[model samples]
Target: MSGILAGKRILVTGVITDASIGFHVAKFAQEEGAEVILTGFGRLSLVERIAKRLPKPAPVIELDVQNQEQLDGLEGKIREYLGDDASLDGVVHSIAFGPQGAFNFLEASWEDVSTAVHVSAYSLKSLTTACLPLMEERGGSVVGLTFDAQFAWPKYDWMGVAKAALESTSRYLARDLGAKNIRCNLIAAGPVKSMAARSIPGFEELADVWKHRAPIGWELSDAEPAARGVVGLLSDWFPKTTGEIVHVDGGVHMMGA
Candidate 1:
């Protein structure tokens, strides 16, 4: 109860497994004395089960970033637990997805590309805006997860483009929301062997890049570094930092080929 996040309320989305960075972010947030709420898409029951694994019990809300109905109703659903006048100090967006077709940049159709951008890129804006009413008055942090979009990785394809869009979205959100005292930023995390990673075609090829380029070395199984970065941004420590991408990639982003 006496940690950096003491008395803070945070909403974390896309926690599907204990191995995920999102799950660790939720865990660390609570350990740092924050009240954490979670949102999951598709398998609500599974997500609920995963939530129980946290040090403290967190309420799970169903959210599909692509579902406008869900987006529109998000704040109300959050209020169901936190009360009618609830406010949030932080919101973690760890959500992203792409259809298999999106893995092939050359052959990917508009539908595939659109879905990738909508869920991975556009959702950042939608999710943050949905939480604006809760955060605007007092201001808070909006932290999103991203892969370094500076260069194309093997098999990443359109997802890389989507990340670029996501990075841009954060900057614009920071620009527009700064007047309201809100801060929007992202953590460009290294590859982890998460459920989301498994879904990516040729994920190891992407992971392999870290093996060679990470100057300080990288652990594909570890997510705590990135999670710690997220909690750091959420804390009051970075009040002046916004529209920034903190790299938690063991220096991989800086290494050149």
Candidate 2:
């Protein structure tokens, strides 16, 4: 297939390593002819190294979503890199984080839960609005990565709460941005062996359930399909679709048996 995203300029956040889901999105976005820029939190060297793995090495910008200054200055920073006249075609919000103990509800503290909510959930709103200046008037798509948190999962704990909030945030964004022709959606992906997942206690057990329940079967290591789903939503193909949750979970979210 020819590139569905040709001439599109996209900003992708949360690229920490080659194993990152955002990394795959950036790589594939370039392959599909989109001009892609990346954002990293704290670890600039790590994101720089990961940027080398993309089809074309993309410039990495510093964006700690939790930091108000970073959020406030994102549009100008991105414009400086992409050129002052450039407008964004899409945004991939792959940023999320949770304290280790938050993965264990029984051991999680209020502070930790609030941190997770702020980082994993609220950051989507922050980052999206920060980049809205680049997307405003022109219209574009916003794709966020999420796990299925509508239902509970072992070891997912407060991160699950964060994901639920993330899902809700996407919908509200979709509603408000719809009149402007900006689409907001999310990919409810299955568990994959990413750096963040490794931090969760007993992630292996959660992986095992998908193997048995997913109709199309699920692999913990594969990220390509998930990346494709994200790009599709960001493409013109889903023009009328907003506030929707697209599942890239191998049909697991739909099955009851």
Candidate 3:
């Protein structure tokens, strides 16, 4: 493990398939010379199966972001797995979810919306803090994924609002975690054909936003570019940057139209 991230240990969450942002992040992180550990959300068997597909074998740990017990025990669980020598230099939080009800803005309920906010937005804070003990000692980075939540997008209702909350939460994490030299940032990626995207009721409509508006153009199938941005943030290159949202959406965020 000796490359840009040589000697770094990173924890990656939310990897379901090869098409996932987390999958690409972890894949590239390993290629860049980081030892990776993954937190499989709920589906340990499936996540473990997917882990074997990485460049190297990554040990899978169980983590349920909303489950306080899992959050409470993650540090020890990781410690026991890696022995006392385990210390993380970076973490990738690519977790997000919104119930079916939350997709239609007009029909969404508070319960569904809260679930989105909790899982998609609040988990950033939860995952960051849960991993801090391992990170703070050496000073590291926390990178998460988000979509631009600045405006309402079709079929992206409560999750969009949740991303707005996620955006705010990252800034606050940067403010508080700065003292410990732990940088937390996000990548607001454009739509890609991941499992998460496919799950959206009107995913194609959302994809069109990028197709027509992004000044640099866009790709709905390639997630590598965005994944690269996440890996870059996790590296030491952006040492002074935190609480910032780096747009990897083909310059879409910069356009007014």
Identify the candidate with maximal lDDT.
1
Give the total clashing residue pairs for model 2. 0
Query: Candidate 3, 219: how far from true, in Å?
Result: 1.7
Off by over 4 Å in 3: none
Candidate 2 ranges with C-alpha deviation above 4 Å: none
Instruction: For model 3, state the Cα shift of residue 39 in Å.
Output: 1.0
How are the candidates ranked when ordered by lDDT, highest leading? Answer: 1, 3, 2
Model 3, range 1-257, lDDT digits (tens) per residue? 56778878899998988888899899999999988999988779988999999999899989999999999999998898677867889989999999999998988999999999999999999999999989878999999999998888888989999999999999999999999999999999999898888889999987888878888888888889999999999998999999999999989888874
Global CA lDDT computed for model 1: 0.96
Superposed model 1: Cα runs more than 4 Å off: none
Point out the worst 10-residue segment of candidate 2 by lDDT: 95-104
Report the number of backbone clashes for model 3: 0
TM-score of 1: 0.99
Residue 104 of model 1 has an lDDT of 99
For candidate 2, write residues 1-257 as lDDT tens digits: 36999999999998877888899999889999899999988879989988988888899889888899988998898889888998999999998888887887888899899999999999889988998889997899999999988788877889999999999999999999888789999999998899988888898988888988898988889888899999999899998999999999999898885
Candidate 2 RMSD to the correct structure: 1.2
TM-score of each: 0.99, 0.97, 0.97
Scored by TM-score, the top model is 1
